[model samples]
Target: MSEVPPRAATAAALLIDALRRAGVRYLFANFGSDHPAIIEALAADRERGLQAPAVVLCPHEYVALSAAHGYAAVTGEPQAVLVHTDVGTANLGGAVHNAARARVPVFVFAGLTPFTLEGELPGGRNTHINHLQDTADQHALVRQYVKWSYDIRTGRNVPQLVGRALQLATSAPAGPVYLTGAREVLAEEVPVPEVAADRWGPVARVPAPEAVVDELIADLQAARAPLVVTSYLGRTQSSVDKLVAVAERLGVPVVEYNAEVLSFPHDHALHLGDDPHPFVAAADVVLALDTDVPWIAASAQPPAGAKVYVVNEDPLQESIPLWYLPADHHVRADSGLVLDQILDRLPAGEDPRAARRAAEAAAAGRRIRAEHERAAAADMAAGRLTPATVARVIAGLVDEETIVLNEAISVAPEVWKHLPRTLPGTLYGNRGTSLGWSGGGALGIKLAAPDSTVVAIVGDGTFYFSVPSATYWIAQRYGLPVLTVVLDNGGWNATKRNLRRQYDGGAADRTDRYWVNLQQSADFPGIAAAAGQARGTTVTRFEDLEDALRAGLDDVAAGVPAVVSVRLDPISHQAEDPV
Candidate 1:
């Protein structure tokens, strides 16, 4: 008979080994009383020279999940995150929501309170805190946000449970998955199964059907004006190139709306500005690729006689409860695969009107860009650092290798106007509208793209929400340096605008309206200095913005984290109007 192979002495050891073998490079962790066994197992593995997924200690659960989210966004590989019991899992809800919306793969693991009070297992309850920490349904904390959730039932089920979670996370319509590790289960000894590393890798991406491709091509061929609108198309460099090729070849105008990733070359002749409403209203054939809200229905919609095609791996966007975008043709397949197939099948030569369309689009794009620049200049000359000017100066400073993470909602459209991202993986934003994602997301991007400069452009309101002290300490502790630029508008400007638009001259119009003002701004630079790992600077003058930004960028390039807080003007009533 064949001799039995060795097995991991503890369930936690087997779980860690399984994750490492599954291509996870890092495990962001926030420990608690329930994590002792897993922590010990990790230390033991390190001592045994079996490290692959290095453990990164995070100060908070939100940071851990956000870091994991950012890492997955850049690497295109699912990463692991370990959190404490109920409270830690509760803190992860927002970040998990962001990951779910972004469709980034994250494997989240949380420890459960001990199952026994009499020490039936190696790590069973020894203190009263265990009983208090135990919840009736801990997994429910993140159940709705994740693609799948499980509580490990037995020590022997660790390998299968973990493997299943990873598989679900990396599968089509990828998102986060959660698994709770019972303290007793983690400590119990069981024979580890010999699960193959590739046993549960991402399922193969199937191309779109030939009939759908042909119909799409036929529509493109027949249409006088074609437009492509996307939000999260540029997951890979090849996808970006392929989409660009298809648009240029077909003479289609591409608009990226609320783009979380750089979907197209902004400088391309056929590339339209960020807003899709105008183009969507004009195009005869509208191809919406991977965009959730192609156009706000109340404010804008496709022309009455236009045909719309919506393509995505998950056509319905199941994560979102109330998505009501209209589409005539909903092709459910991998976006990159569909684009590649379209490129392969498109007619050899350009249409008769291709040149004219291209020229007209190019001219319009130039006009739009110029208008934005003029508006920015006007705003700056008025003695305030406009969002556009700040974005433009930063755009001038950054190269193709820089990665920009933006969560400044009010000024994001303005920033995109100045910073024409031409490279894939060079831009990311909050698709889920989470306030504190950028600060932690920037750190994750820096970890994944250590050679590239990572910058987090956030608002003053967002800066406060980001848990600045914890984020900075994590950066310093892990040696991940990212330039953090705070667009200080003195308050929740977006909220203020909404109130004015919704209430008009009602109670909200009063200057003393409750919870609207954040008039007393904190010294952000001083806050950074207190962290001991980051340096900070505050720029109040428009003329000083450039120098301050350059200095902060220099500091980041020198392997130190830096913050540049630029005082922005109040939201202009005419902010949304064209120049």
Candidate 2:
């Protein structure tokens, strides 16, 4: 005879059970008093030996949401967040957009006043909530951005409904889910089901269609000067290994497209940087996998007779110039699945060109490295805040697990070289040109991997404009800590460079837009401590660098999100104001 669980479990208990069944092990929470019933239920679970929720306190809703995004995206397990009422959701709106754009799966839970429970004074202060009692309308605000949103209605239906929500959140094209629980429903009793054991970790095998593989083999076998371009496929560890294998078999070049992140190690000889225009123009055949196609051939000018092949699930139909480049063929399916197909078809015989081409790429990679070093050394000698040194020091601090969420446009390449990634450890900045995305993303990464230290390497311009106020919540409130390493070089280095390049030898600082160039020296560490009582430090001496990095990581690991501000000399290339 089996014992059935009690019917006295509250909505919180039911919801928590659903998450546990789905293999949820951690929460990135920022609490509020929008509803007492839900709060009390969580408290009761903690008391009754259900195990205290492993919660990471974050500084702001943006940070909380961003951390959740990173955790879910990398781990391939859905992350959880508890947003307050309307105000809290509004504050987190930008970060929510960032996650939605990334297609990362997370559950954004919020509490709205129950229509039945509010006395005469339900809508205390949430202006967006109609009254103290509200409908599920407020919860739907995230629908355009998140995959799904729901308000838990009755207690009796909860245990099952929660499971459905989990399914939707972790499904393919994974994105965030928004759920609301009425205060009264959260208090009501329900028959509890035993927590379902985790049956999913991350789905790794994507079986390629054999028919497609045959066609691809025929197409690839004909390519004279073939090239491989990769995108978001870096989501899985197998991605790098698979892509590397496929490229090597053909003795072809593998380039990372819009490679805002380290898709393949820069050290690989085959890895031509993202802008393969130079090589693509000459390539007899170019294959793009999981990339936004237009970006690979948008200039309306590819080399004559170059054939372009695409492999992706969704062949984007809107505003995409499909005919601009000579379309050789299209395989509409998952990227990993397609790669698996190609691997199966690779011939067993050794490729003579493989060694030679790889050697050439390796040599080229070394030359590029030397050029970068000379440029960095020049900037270091210029006595301005160079982004290179700041990136170098920060990159050296991260191990294989650490993630760097960077938003500096001018110094991205230098940063990539200084701290190249092992497979699947790094995430790129947003592809949409959204500036503040990295600050929120760093927070999201921390929430997702609570045990792993996350660092947001921001440019001085980005920190001052977006992240300066973002850390208050993490440092002062919910205790989830992430170190923000600000690369302060005093101005918009990238923008000025672009402007100077566009205009021949123009005096950029002539207008010197004082706003673009800060007129006053900022006391960054002092400002950081004041914003959220974050332990702050200024790194000026190379001798004191390692210790500062260790201290920051330790504090963040201990749940005290801190900021390390480094002031570097500007790269000397901007002396004439490239902008």
Best by TM-score: 1
Model 1: pairs clashing at backbone N, Cα or C within 3 Å:
none
TM-score of each: 0.95, 0.81
Ten contiguous residues minimizing lDDT sum, candidate 2: 117-126
lDDT of 2 by residue, 1-579 (tens): 221236467767677656655667666676766656656656666666565355666557776776676666667777678877676787676677767666677878887765552353332333434364354467656767777777787767665666666677666556788888756567667776554434433333345468757766665566656677776777765677777777777666776766545567666767766556666666666777766653544543346777677775444532233434346666566777777778877778876666565666566557766777787677656544456766666666777767777676677666765666665666566553445666556655665566777787777777765555655555455555778777777777777776766764556545554235642268766776777677878877656666887788888777777777776664333223365
Off by over 4 Å in 2: 1-5, 116-140, 190-206, 293-301, 317-327, 353-360, 381-384, 394-402, 426-454, 464-482, 491-510, 513-520, 531-534, 539-562, 568-579
TM accuracy, model 2: 0.81
Candidate of highest lDDT = 1
Alpha carbon lDDT at 65, candidate 1: 84
Model 1: how far residue 483 lies from native, Å: 0.7
